[model samples]
Target chain A: MLLLQSALVQSALVQAALGALPAARPTWNLALPGQLLGALGPDLLLAGGAVLLLLVAVARPESDRHQRAVGWASLGLVGLTIVAVVAYASRGALATEGPIAVDTFRWAVDIVVLIGTGCTIALSMESNPLDGILTAESHVLVLFSAAGMLLLAAARDLILVFLGIELMSVAVYILSGLDRRSERSAEAALKYFLLGAFSTGFLLYGIALVYGATGSTNLATIGEHVARYSLMYNPMLVAGVALLLIGFSFKVAAVPFHMWAPDVYEGAPTPITAFMAAAVKVAAFAAFLRIWLDAFPTVAYQWHNAIWLLAVLTMLVGNVVALRQRNLKRMLAYSSIAHAGYLLVTVVVANSLGASAFLFYLVAYTLATMGAFAVVIALGEPGERNQEIADYAGLWTVEPWLAAAMAVFMMALLGFPIAGGMGFFAKWYVIDAAIHAPHPQTVLAVILVLASVISCGYYLGVVLTMFMKPRPANAPAVRPVPTGTFLVIYLSAFTLLLFGVLPNGFVQLAHDSVPISMVGAPARAPVASAASR
Target chain B: MYPLFYSFCFYLFGLIAIASALAFVTRRSPVAAALWLVNVLFCLAALYVMLDAPFIAAVQVLVYAGAIMVVFLFVVMLLNLGLPGELADARGLLAKILAGLAGIVLLAKIMSSRTAVPIESLMLRPDSLATVARIQGAVAPVAQPLFTEYLIAFEVTSILLLVAAVGAVLIGRRRAAAVEGVGAG
Candidate 1:
């Protein structure tokens, strides 16, 4: 009788505990191909292309002809991915489930990355052969890197972000050291790998801390938790945010963490340098904007001062250092650093207009930088000679068309008004956003202008050296321009002019692409928060 | 009486793990360090078992002490390091001091953070050992989460491994080719 009574009490306790437990969470359906494809069409396309390229590379590893063919095929695949993204954008389809997000902001960034990839492939066709990097693996690595960039831009979870970053960075590290014969290339690769791994450690630790504090890795859930719990002063969350900012600052080449940029940029293959300066920056900034705006806007006040200081220092150091650089590649590397500062200013603004401005500036910077690097590659021969600023002396006499294109790129980078270049409008948009920000960011705007004025010193210096200075008698004769390189140069220059003269269409596209739920309307909070609740 | 026994076991395993870890790091010889690390791993496995996670405990021993340590030993032997004293870091005194200072700062930061809260408070669904063992068993609780919510991460990890494998092959082949060409010349 005593044993029977004990069994009854145990049953009653079990029943009560079961009743108090939360309901079972819903499981995602991973078997549905159609829905998954609809959500991840562009990403799947890029990943498939990468795998196909890798298989082809393994099959024909020794054929230079096969490598060139793979390069062209990768370019075609990027073009197709862009078309699919545009189709999705037109349908206004968005996915907010799992670790991926498909929306206008992602599509817009995808387009930029695809265009940059296409241009890089085209530029690499002849340049890689010259630099002893013409292996089939080089083309395959580019495709994989592009896929990683797409994933980086579309990720909504911290784990996915880290994976995407590693995928992209590992491929780029290999590409940087592709010239196995050069010690400088090996040094650049080693430096990049070490520093990149260190920053990744900081990023992963920050993610772990943020997850500990908020009990979620989903951006929307973290945002909701911060809002509901008033965790603005939470020490763990603050430290995580600071660490994340440092990691991103290193990736984007912001000042104080900008030491690796110049060396890596100068030592990498010129075409790869162009890709890193353009597509990699676009993807990193995309991730940076999404995380900060979607996850931590509620506590913006805590991070705003830190970003402001980063911007000011980045601007001062980037432009001031570029003034002293004699190597053209190093100068452009510093220029890219200064551009990151301007982009950070837009991030600080953190409004719909600011988002649009950020997109526009990335487009402008990408076009000008790609065009500029094409000129650099054309000047650099098989032995990596003629990379000095003095190498551009009397380029106008030797190669008039190339000289003209280089002049246009330099003017665009300088933001000269008479040239009506895209850089001018891009800076104008940034300044306007800063002035119209919720907080008084007028001082940032003034600093931006001052930095632009300082930038003119180097930009115009390049132009003058190319056009006005006398040609060196011993200058190596200009090689015949490859068709692929010529195409990249012309396409970049034409688009820059078109956008500069008629910025309205591109501006409209960027404005329409603003992530409404996150930035514009705050009424419809991120879908993850609602669904999780 | 049961709680006292459990606490005693926990402290015993924890102390063993800590001591083994210290020895692992301080050993001058690579082989000795690896052997000490195996001891640390075994102690951790014991701690995991005491926490009613027998699955994790098994993995802790199989993966870390078994497979990983074998690989470590193989690499140590292949390298044929000349002497223990020659293996020490050749940095200046200032660099060593700075590294030590940085490590101390990191330790202090971690200790002061909220992460140092009592382990009992960190459990999402606390239960007695008997209840945990009876309700979910060892493997089911871990398997459910690993196969479901973390499925994507698991697949991505496979891709990462594949990329690393390919990169290793490419780099190794290139070095081999360069070395052979030099010898032939």
Candidate 2:
């Protein structure tokens, strides 16, 4: 009887030890609003600026001076936000424990977006009422859109990605139609809204399917599930990924889904066009890269072929269609589509070097595209005339400096001689990345080179018209470049050239900004579980 | 004891939903069509309730039938569309045939997929009376995840609504300006 009692006592002790195992499970701590604000500093700043601009508009109704003040204030806010992002990056604080991530990648993308927005504001500073009625609301819309871009770049959750896309898209749709007097602007707005809403449906459906398949919407949790389960062949996951690819393809204006680009790009205000082309592309591509690299890295082989086909088709269709375009804005729109193809190739490579190349190419492309559009803005009168290639005839003689800026932009866009501009280096880096990828994509690299050569047909067409073609008798004389536009053109051109000649420093920055540990890798497990929760 | 009654209610709601949806699409007048849509929504809500999701059923009635139907009525009344004949289908016969074919194909695909995946196996819990009692309360399970894991999404939805409101005002103000300018001229 004594022995049996002792055995029971030992059994109780073993049961107590086994019950303590679950105490090791990590418990999540809720982030405070103050901490969230610190992590999302740039987004909050831009949002606050937007609200302030709206209040300013309401208080001082329609005064042009007040509007200009609002514009400058918006510019200052964007500039300050860039500084904040850089500061946040320098602090090396990883506050990405919540839905948003404030890592080096986010900071670099934020800087790109903010700089593009600032340049756009400068380009729009001398707003012609006839071209588009620039209200304080325009600047406010831009600020809100920039906030959305920041959120998108930093989004670590699928829900945040959807919200960020919506916020950015809605603001842009309104901005696209801000020129109330232009029927084309209204049409652009309507078409973009309809198609954009359709694409958002696909995106939401994809998110729903992904959540259903993985039982989680948190990207890290999804990645963990994928890694643990080897869910590559799940039909629901495959469908979700396809829908997501389609949705992003529409946003980036990849061919077969790019029906809205040329019209929307041409009909929107010139500065807004530049802003959309640069900032929107950057934001969308950033989200695309993050989502594919983080959540779906385990299934890379499954989706890589689809992306490959998209890249090829986008490059071919964009350049070929652009060759037939006579309007300069439409041509640039097609060129932008072609560039999207190149960017998509880098995404397919899906390596740290590819990420760095993507960033570098984005910088080069943003500068060149914005600079080119600045020239367009400078030449355009109140009614948005002088958009034809013929309109740019003998531009070299009329405005030598503006013509020279346009030439530099064209050469950069063409990816000419290695010494010609940054675009060449950007292309080279992307090709190098493709070559060095785990599964080298030599075919894609060849297609990229061939497509670049084809693109020269249109980009050089603009250059040739500017320098060689004589002024048509009916062509309007070039308007004197505004100081704001002149500043934008020279700054972007100078940066383009400097980065081209000495790309090492910027290349290092790009390399350092790559979120290598975040992509594909599981997040760190929580250290200490809540004691006896 | 409950199986026969449950299937009866399920089929009743499902048939009503399908029939009302067809009627909603085929109606001549916008107001009549909207009323039919409300009926369809109510039927779907009933179906949801029968499927052990009372919260979703309530939302379906409140959001789809009440709120959305009101908006539809408002728009139809605002436009005062002239006649059913004027709004009749204008597509070619070939297009109509193609659309019908596509619809049939989609229906077949859905049916096949549904058959391939047995609904009994898809259930998270055994379909017993006790399990039903345990699982029927839908709000708490959904509310927990929505408030915790998806709190950011919920907040962002509010922002999206705000953006939509602002965009509407901007576009509406522009239209008003254009109309005023035309009136003055």
lDDT of 2 at B59: 94
Q: A1-104 in candidate 1: lDDT tens per residue? A: 66445534543432232212124322233235456545777887888777877888888655669878888888888889987877666566555555677567
DockQ of 1: 0.36
Model 2 - which docking category? medium
Listed per candidate, the RMSD to the true structure in angstroms reads 14.1, 13.6
TM-score of each: 0.84, 0.84
lDDT by residue for model 2 (A387-427), tens:
88888988888788888889889889888855347888888
Instruction: Report the Cα lDDT for residue A246, model 2.
Output: 93
Residue A185 miss distance in model 2 (angstroms): 0.8
Residue B113 displacement in candidate 2 (angstroms): 18
Worst 10 residues of 1 chain A by lDDT: A522-531
lDDT of each residue in B1-185, candidate 1, tens digit only: 39999899989989998899888767778788889999999999998888777887899999999988987887677578535754577546798689779989998988788566668756656565435655878666667656766665666666666665666677677677668768999
Cα lDDT listed for each candidate: 0.80, 0.80
